[model samples]
Target chain A: MARVVVDVMLKPEILDPQGQAVQRALPRLGFEGISDVRQGKRFELEVDGPVDDAALARIHELAETFLANTVIEDFTVKVEEVAEAAK
Target chain B: MARVVVDVMLKPEILDPQGQAVQRALPRLGFEGISDVRQGKRFELEVDGPVDDAALARIHELAETFLANTVIEDFTVKVEEVAEAAK
Candidate 1:
């Protein structure tokens, strides 16, 4: 089996209101030294069947098509074999 | 300058209560096809002076030491040159 992890983040120059909101709220949480806060999404997928180059490609396609907004956001794709996971 | 993006994700087997809560709440947001929701953090840092191998090493160590809870989460570090960023 293979495990794929996808991360979606806001573009650098894009204004992040969500992040600004979070940062404004952080003082109440007692989290100091936190100059800023940015929220992002993470997806973890486990492919039970064979996951090779084709599977990787499919995951990338999904990321580009649905999971991310290429204009205001940029994303990265990470894949690993489940068998190699530290136990 | 260099921009570093760091992503932190929960371990596969970890019981993600926050994710489950978000999944249950997503029906209100009209987001279909999303069967699960895992929350993660992303950090974007821009280094202006000189960013070389040594700077990359410092960032990695920060990921290891404080940025992530290594027990329940793992992280990936991606580094890119700001000058080379597609504009």
Candidate 2:
């Protein structure tokens, strides 16, 4: 199995109302030292496969298609193999 | 000045209750294709500094002291210098 981390955030030009709302709510959450909130989404996915360039490409496609909005958001993909094959 | 990105995540041995709650909420939020949720946090900070080794180290300290729970969380800090002085 392989573990993948994906993060999706608003484009710089987009107005992030949801993030703004989260910011507004933080004062009551006992969090200080933050002047603003730029909220985003994160996903950790576990896939069963031998990780290779092929796995990277397929997951990236899935990320672009379903996990991210190309127009208003950008995403990064991080992958780690959970188990190493015996060498 | 410089920019920093800090990511805080649950320790490998800990149970992520908040992450689990968020995962349960996602399907109700109309997000499909996800069977589990492992949530984490990301922070972007802009600090006024020349961004030398010292700046990097101080930010790492802040990350350890206030931004993360040392016993239950692990953090990584990334710094980007915003400008440079004439040399």
Candidate 3:
């Protein structure tokens, strides 16, 4: 099977309270020199067959509709390179 | 400032209900050809200065302690190569 990865992140304009919380917690945890902490989502998919262009297109559509809330977030899709499975 | 990205994923043996839910919902939504679906987290950290080896080591420590719950999850950290910011 082929593996596809989808990365979903909040829009740049959106206020990420979770990220801010992490940033604040970092200093308290003694990890300094860090500023912005943006949190995002990643989805890994194992497709049933070869990861051809058609498979990639379908995954992209899936990402647009199900994986991401496009109104507030943006997403990118990538396919991992895999070796052929042993017989 | 330098940017560090942390990719956190659940251990392969762990059951990922959310990912399973997404997988089950896909075919109903007419997105076929997908099988295994695993969901994870991504963290983008913007550091206050140049991304030297020291900064990377610190980020790695932060990732091991706070960015990820090492018990159930595995995380990888990478530093982004950014052009020097405008003066």
Candidate 4:
């Protein structure tokens, strides 16, 4: 099997309250020097076969269409690994 | 500044309902061949200085204590980038 990873993050212009909350909490927790924190989503898909360019294209489409909201978020898709079974 | 990325994922034995939901929806959405899906969190920390070993150790502590629930989740921290200003 091949593992594909998709990371979806909010656009820089968008307000990320979740990230802000974490950033604010950091100081109280004694973790300092972190100026910003942005929280995002990561998806790992186990594909049944080798991950070729075509597979990557399809995964990119899936990331753009189903995984992320283009209006406010951006996503990146990459092949993480190929299991021994696939090799 | 440097960008540190912390990826928090559920333990292999833990149930991931959100990932299961996405996996189920994929076939319905005309995407197939994905046998399984796992969802996780990615945090981007923009630090005010260089990301050295000491910085990484501190980030690891933060990730363990504040970002992930140690009982059910695992986390990995890596330096994504160091901005030119920090160089």
Please tell me which predicted candidate would have the highest DockQ against the true structure.
4
Where does model 1 exceed 4 Å of error? Answer: A18-39, A52-66, A69-72, A76-78, A82-87, B11-13, B18-39, B53-66, B69-72, B82-87
By TM-score, the best candidate is 4
lDDT of 2 by residue, B1-87 (tens): 556677778886898776677556655654444445566776666555466687677668766876679999888887734656552
State in Å the error of residue A35, model 1. 12
lDDT of each: 0.66, 0.67, 0.89, 0.94
Higher-lDDT candidate of 3 and 4: 4
Which of the CAPRI classes, incorrect, acceptable, medium or high, describes model 2?
incorrect
Provide the lDDT at A47 for model 2: 57
The Cα error of candidate 1 at residue B55, in Å, is: 3.3
Question: Whose lDDT is greatest here?
Answer: 4
Candidate 1 lDDT by residue in tens digits, A1-87: 566677788877888887677556545554333355556777665554555677677667767766688988888888744565443
Q: In model 4 chain A, where is the ten-residue run with the lowest total lDDT? A: A78-87
Reference-based TM-score, model 2: 0.60
Give me the iRMSD of candidate 3, please.
0.9
Mind giving the per-residue lDDT tens digits that candidate 3 earns over B1-87? 877899999999989998999999999999888879999999989888888888888899999999899999999988875657772
Clashing pairs in 3: none
B1-87: candidate 4 lDDT, tens digit per residue: 989999999999999999999999999998999999999999999998878899999999999999999899999998998879636
The alpha-carbon root-mean-square deviation between model 4 and the true structure, to one decimal in Å, is 1.3
Order the candidates by TM-score, highest first.
4, 3, 2, 1
Q: TM-score of each model's B chain?
A: 0.78, 0.76, 0.91, 0.95
